[model samples]
Target: MVTGDLLMAARAGDGESFRALVEPHRRELHVHCYRMLGSVQDAEDMVQETLMAAWRGFDGYAGRASVRSWLYRIATNRCLNALRDGARRPRAGATFGVTPPPPTRLVEPNSLQPYPDSLLDGVPDIAPGPEARVERREAISLAFVTATQSLPPRQRAVLVLRDVLGFRAAEVAEMLDTTEESVTSALKRARSRMPRERPARARGTEELALAAAFADAMERGDVPAMVALLTDDAWLTMPPAPQEYQGRQVIGEFMRVVAFRDGARRYRLIATSANGQPAFAAYGFDRGDPVGHPRGVLVLTIEGDRISVITRFENSAMSCFGLPGTLEGSDHRDGV
Candidate 1:
């Protein structure tokens, strides 16, 4: 049925019609929320709220705007509300008094989560079109999301709507209930504050090769070889822990002391992708357990041939990447 027919049926309380109308936009809307909140869990919550709000208010959704725009309007405002409530601020870093390494600014910690590629399968390519300066994939990069945290909630919304999603200034203004001039000004400021350069490209045979080698080095307990894969100004950070290790020397030292301390049995890495970048799930073997358990998810930021940043999340996020809660058997080659 046409969207108009779906809308009419949806307004009359046809649940099936409502689902059909909204399902196509689900993944993209979820991604929109993720960009706004910088937390997958939070984004998931916001998407639920947006959908609920949309369903309840479907009758009142005037046809002045497309259904997609109307949905974005609701989602954007929900994110703004969450931001204004200060309920989604970055958490404090690790309690240890270790100073952040040089060249790596330990910004206030936030509830950053990795986005699995598996979940992105049906997400429409809402990337900016030919006229847009930003690449569609780069807009979803972890680097871009992290940089966006620095923007005020409204400005962040403006930049994402206008630049990232390729929405017109007038349409964004309508969504935000602001003037087009205001959106333009806010977007300009947001652009200035965001990171100037996109991080190393996440897709390519070379990138895959680099990620494979990194995973191989870790799996084989080759610390030196692993360290060689990093740039001199590399960074290592575990969020909600606040401790950021910068520089290859500092990162290597910490890896030796903590990550690889108990020989190669400490952890095993399975290659994966998160936030559109190379990532891995680090499974650590318990003292006597036959199998290693999920420890944490590590995402690497590459620059040229070397990795510049390594961000690790607590083990609680294993399921977000569609990983098994426990590695049942010795065979870890499932997802690699």
Candidate 2:
């Protein structure tokens, strides 16, 4: 077969043929590792390890399974090993100089990072085809990814492979080096932990309208108008800092004391999308600078017409989100 010939050529030290065989699956595999590890940098490292292992073990590849499946097997095992070693979990709050409030019952994924839409250019939009049961967008949402972090490592892998990626039970078992019965058992527990449906969030024109109104209020320091757009139980969190503010009263206090206390700081918000949600790249001006420097990235979780959660990440991560380090001119706004 053509693929067998290519594999043979690749093993014979033909670098071009090897790349031709593996290049197509690179992005998808990276996304898979991101879901497992919850960090983009970790995912990138895992992908390199997977490919290197494949290249070194080429002789053991009997061509019984497709190259894609083989690569996934390698990657999955690598991630599992990393998890077992505790080498990749989020650091403690004290390490970041954060004093976390009493632990709430709600599960929060630590060290959560945003996935840029630009990196998703060539990735296929996963939909419920005859083979796949879950929509691609739901699988990649920030909420969903955070929820998976609560599950045990094996259960997480089973749920993602079975439901998100649409891999059959037998296929998943083979990948994990387990029996189908074990895979089914793990999947049952995983599904029970997952919500019956993805959480409802504003979409399309409604989402655009909300984001615009929210940005406008922040720019003008309109506290009441900003408060009007939040759900009663809205939550605000800035990761790497364990502080979380919930409920309208507490959030308003946060806005008044921390954000708008010194008066409105000049900001420019450029629209972007992350984790299948609307996000903005925020740029703040120094006293007399003509242009603004990156402040942070804000990702919103909307429930119905009101925003439910605001997840803000540090400005140091702006580069990964495909945002420029500086914005020029007095006014820079991009309509969503």
Candidate 3:
């Protein structure tokens, strides 16, 4: 059935029609919420709220705006409301056992979480609008999302609508219930404040090879070899925690003193992908258990043949990627 027919049937209180109408946009809307809120859990919550609101207000939907825009309007406002209410903010950094090197600087409080590449599978790509400058991949990169964290909630919404998701200025204004001029101004400020870092150009074969090398070095407990895979100015950051390590020397020291403190401890890296980058679910064996226990998820940002950034999340993030909390020998080869 055409969308109009679906809409009419949906408005008549046919639940199946409503589901059919909205289901196609589910993944993309979740992504939109993720971009706005930065946490998969929070994004999921807001998407729920958006869909519920859409359902409740289906009778009132004027049909003038496209369904996608209407849903975005609802989702964006819900995120803004959460931000304004102070109900959503970065969680505190996960506590680490080891005492190690001093950080270069404390990064801003970021509740940023990785989005599973698997969830991105069926999300239909929308071409960038005329004024949109941010590419699709960069929009979803950890660096870009982290930079957006520093923005005011409204500006973040505007930037994501206008630049990231490629909504037009007028359309964004309508979504936010503001003037087009306001949207334009907010986009300008947001663009100016965003950190200029871009996603590394490495992709496909080069990315796989580099990630495999890092994994091999990690499994062998070779900190130096792992460090060799990093670029000279590489960064290592743990989200939710402000600590950021820069440069191969500093990062290598951090790994030696903290990550490998148990003396060449072998790790199991279950390969995965997050935020369109190669990631692994790292595990360590317990004294009695043959299977490895969940440690954390490590996401790598590659530039050319070397890793430019390494961001590790707490073990709690494993569930977000559909990773099992514990891994048996047979589970080793399966991707999460």
| Candidate 1 vs 2: which has more lDDT | 1
What lDDT tens digits, residue by residue, belong to model 1 across residues 27-70? 99998999998888888999999999999998898889988889
> What lDDT tens digits, residue by residue, belong to model 3 across residues 235-331?
9999888899999999998987778765634468889998888999998764455687788899998887899999998887899988777767622
Report clash pairs, candidate 3.
none
TM-score of each model, paired residue for residue: 0.91, 0.89, 0.94
Off by over 4 Å in 2: 92-109, 125-131, 286-291, 328-336
Candidates in order have lDDT scores of 0.81, 0.79, 0.85
lDDT of 1 at 123: 91
Name the regions of candidate 3 deviating beyond 4 angstroms.
197-200, 286-289, 329-336
Sliding window of 10 residues with minimal summed lDDT for model 2: 95-104
